[model samples]
Target: MAVRHRLIRTSPRSVWAVLADGTRYAEWVVGTASSRPVRGHWPELGSAIGFEVRLGPVSLSNETVVRRCEPGEALELEAKAGPLGTARISIELRPWGDQCLVLVDEHPLRGAGGTLHNVAVEALIQIRHRTMLARLAKICETEAAEAEQRRPLGQVVSPHPDEGGPRA
Candidate 1:
């Protein structure tokens, strides 16, 4: 198994918002050239997203299904990589001060990838996780900053509904 973590300078809710959007999969997921919802509602258990990977003249397609979800807390998925097999990916978010600490754990579950899993493959997964987490952090932080910029200087918007309305 390969596990990696990153500190996103934003709330877990902010990070979850990005993860919950199926269309945004390619934005932060490394190697995914394009993606779309293929079944059910994304981020919900049993929901799936179909994505394509382009490598110069070659293009390959695959799908990822949500196995478990805990709203803003956790999401576990099974990513099917054609004949190479499927992998289990688990993402967990923890509150850290005003930011969120995201942890990703991945391992091959079936197929050729599973049969060939070794140290080199683990290293590659680690590298991919590092870049993937960085992309996620950049997205969450950038969006949070942009949202703050759009609000009035003296205005305050509550992240939760029960907190009250946007106030100035």
Candidate 2:
């Protein structure tokens, strides 16, 4: 099993927003070249997303199905990697002040992956999780910053525009 956590400088809502958009998975998930919703609605239980993983000229097709979901709190998935077998991935979100702490847990459930699982595999998964969480954090933080910049001014207008409050 591989377990890792990351502290994202954004609200859980923002992180969940990214997760809820299945098409965005490739942007944050390690090794996923592209992703698209294949069945039902992504992140919803039983819904699945198809993704292609490319390594140089070689490409492998895989699909991940949502096994469980708790809206902004948690998401559990079963990722099928053809003959390599399947793995269970669980993601949890916890509120830390105004920020979000994301935890990821994964383990091989069946197939060759499970049969061949060992310390080296666990280490590899740890590295993947570390990179994946960093990618997710970057996306969420950047999105939050962009959203802040785009937000309309509050009701209170500043007497001087240079003061940085809402312009009169």
Best by lDDT: 1
- Candidate 1 Cα misplacement greater than 4 A, ranges: 157-162
lDDT of 1 by residue, 22-104 (tens): 99989999999999999999899999999999999999999999999999999999999999999999999998987899999
The candidate that wins on TM-score is 1
Go through the candidates in order and give each one's C-alpha lDDT: 0.95, 0.93
Per-model TM-score versus the true fold: 0.95, 0.90
Q: In model 1, what is the error at residue 100, expressed in angstroms?
A: 0.5
Model 2, C-alpha of 153: deviation from truth (Å): 3.0
Q: Give the deviation of candidate 1 from the true structure as CA RMSD.
A: 1.4
| Model 1 TM-score, all chains together | 0.95
In candidate 1, the residue pairs with backbone N, CA or C atoms under 3 Å apart (3 or more residues apart, or in different chains) clash, namely none
Error of 2 at 136 (Å): 0.4
